[model samples]
Target: MSPLISSFRIAIAAGVLSLFALPAGAAELSKELSTAVTHAGLAAGSPDLKMVQTHLHHVVNCLVGPAGAGFDSGQANPCKDQGTGAIPDAPADKQKLLLTAAALAQGGLAETDLAKAQAAATATQAAIKGAE
Candidate 1:
């Protein structure tokens, strides 16, 4: 397979695995984050909206399945599991900052929202500078 196709297959597999592994409540949070990012990108008129939407769709699909059914309210409540736990309540501020960066990247707002985008990007970049 082509490198691009291979990469896509790998991503799809990972997303499926992640969804199956997440606790019901944590899965909802993940879906919410994906939705927020998509909406923010749309609001920003992101040039890469299609790519962002694809990624978000993959995420939601992986977490919620093909049916697109979101977690029920009770199942969506906050609760963190140990080790492989889901962050039931995702940190709102951090998610906002990350979503801002995603919007800037997708919207190509780097040129238009230069200062704001840069600042947000810098902060988001710092937050994930190192990872395992």
Candidate 2:
């Protein structure tokens, strides 16, 4: 295989391995977060949703894998690293939005939190577009 293809395979393998290694709680959280993002993406029809989803997946891999593979892997935290050294001071509405996304990424919204889920989906769309 070409060098690029080989590298891609290695990365993919590493990501998969990482997911399997997450601590149960972190793995669960990551799953919820990933699900939320995916649902939101599908709802929003935003192309940048793919990029956000990829990043969220990497977060899961990092949590489950060797050191330097998860969100705390020295790379800035995407959720908190929104161009600020500190976690951005998102408004209550935005916090709900992110929480909903994280929840959805981890698992489907509970019936009571469906509104939050929709907000999260919207926030994800806006966040991705702003990043671009």
Candidate 3:
């Protein structure tokens, strides 16, 4: 290849890679956190156990984003386009809260009982409320 063409190709490749490497910005992370809290609240207030689980799944989806583990395509992504994943995008100081919230949301997913799931949802909300 000509030197100029090789250099152009390298620049294109670097630009593509940079897009994936950059972390979510503050505005995107904030939107994700707020959406997660809303999903948790919805789970807690759901009338049926199935709906509770569904909403809890939404919370998990929001926290983890499409690329993170525990993301469920079956559940709607409330935080889509907000960030890569709330936990992954979170600042170092705020990661703990997002992780706690994610754990609570996972627990809610595992719960068979309505009350237990609701409790988990409430706990999930509390854990992330401060970060939002």
Q: Specify the highest-lDDT model's number.
A: 3
> For candidate 3, lDDT tens digit of each residue in 1-132?
899999999999999998777454877888888888888999999988999999888888888889888999988998887889888888899988888899998998899999999999999999989777
Question: lDDT (CA) for every model shown?
Answer: 0.38, 0.40, 0.89
State candidate 1's TM-score: 0.27
Clashing pairs in 1: 46-107
lDDT of 1 by residue, 25-93 (tens): 445555544443443333333344343333333222222233324422232222222112112244444
Ranking by TM-score: 3, 1, 2
Clashes of each: 1, 16, 0
**Measured by TM-score, how close is model 3 to the native structure?**
0.79
* TM-score per model over all chains: 0.27, 0.27, 0.79
Q: What is the C-alpha lDDT profile of model 2 across 1-132, one tens digit per residue?
A: 899999999999999998789565444444434443443466434245444344444332222232221233543243332212111223344445443334333332222254443444466545433322
Candidate 2 displacement at residue 48 in angstroms: 19
What residue runs in model 1 are displaced by over 4 Å at the alpha carbon?
1-20, 46-88, 91-132
- Candidate 2: worst 10 consecutive residues by lDDT? 81-90
Against the correct fold, how does model 2 do in TM-score?
Answer: 0.27
| Least well predicted 10-residue stretch by lDDT in candidate 1 | 77-86
